[model samples]
Target: MADHAEHTEQDKREKLKELVKDARIGMLTTMTTDGKHVSRPMALQDVEFDGDLWFFTYADSDLVAQIRANPQVNVSFSDAKQHAWTSVSGSAVQTDDRAKAEELWNPLLKAWFPDGLETPNLTLVKVHADSAEYWESAHSSKVVTLLGYAKAAVTGKTPDAGENETVRL
Candidate 1:
């Protein structure tokens, strides 16, 4: 019984990792000063799921201020090819650690901060995901999938991403 429970937890972690691996740009939502939800696309940055998700952002950006005022934030990621998606709700905290920021930055981020890694605005945001919900379907057009899933039952192949997860993000 313990083994089965452990397997279930491991499976959930692996599935979450898979979703994060395929997810590049994700929507980051935070509460604004006016009490409205504001979301914008942000890169995955890196996978550090010992228990948290890591992200990079400008220290002085509006999002940072928003997070300061309200730590709660929501993030969403999707697989363009598989149409699988995951959303995480959590608290966001800004960091001033230069080493961590340097470790996560890439050349592509130059577009956001031309001043380079040394840019005074450079920082890392750690998201302690309180809970996550995932949603996926082989394809949203259910009318088209009935025949295909039936065919797979005979041929034996992997089903599409959506067949296995719930969607509420």
Candidate 2:
């Protein structure tokens, strides 16, 4: 039983990484000083997930300011076709590490900053994940989901929604 629990956590962490890797764009939600949640789509910096997520943004951006004011934040990723989704809750910190930025930098990001790493106001936002919860449907196909719904309707049973698990980083 103990082994099973440990394996489950290991599996969840691996699954979270896979999901995030495929869905590079995540909705980063930050809290406003007035207590309102503001979410914006941010491109995930290319890096291996190890309980931390990095993103490139302008130092003077509203998001950077918000994180400085309130470190708590949430990042959510979704792969609709795979029926996989993950929500990560963490504390965000803004860093101006040129070496790290240069390592993660690529031509695609040049669209946002023509000057690349030298672009003024370019900064990296790091999210230190405290915990993450993910949901993955056993049946990834839309057809399978529809069949499950139809079967449930005919048999008066609840459809199998999927699997949900929370793991602490």
What total of clashing residue pairs does each candidate reach?
4, 0
> Which residue pairs collide, candidate 1?
135-166, 135-167, 136-162, 137-162
- lDDT per residue as tens, model 2, 105-158: 989999999998889999999999989988778797989988999999999998
Clashing pairs in 2: none
Provide the global lDDT of candidate 2 against the true structure: 0.88
Best by lDDT: 2
- The best candidate in terms of TM-score: 2
**What does candidate 1's lDDT look like per residue over 1-169, in tens digits?**
0122344655666677778778878899999898999999998777666437777788889989999999999898887565577888888899887888778879898888788787777888888887776665657565556666787788897454343443222
Pick out the ten consecutive residues of candidate 1 with the lowest summed lDDT. 160-169
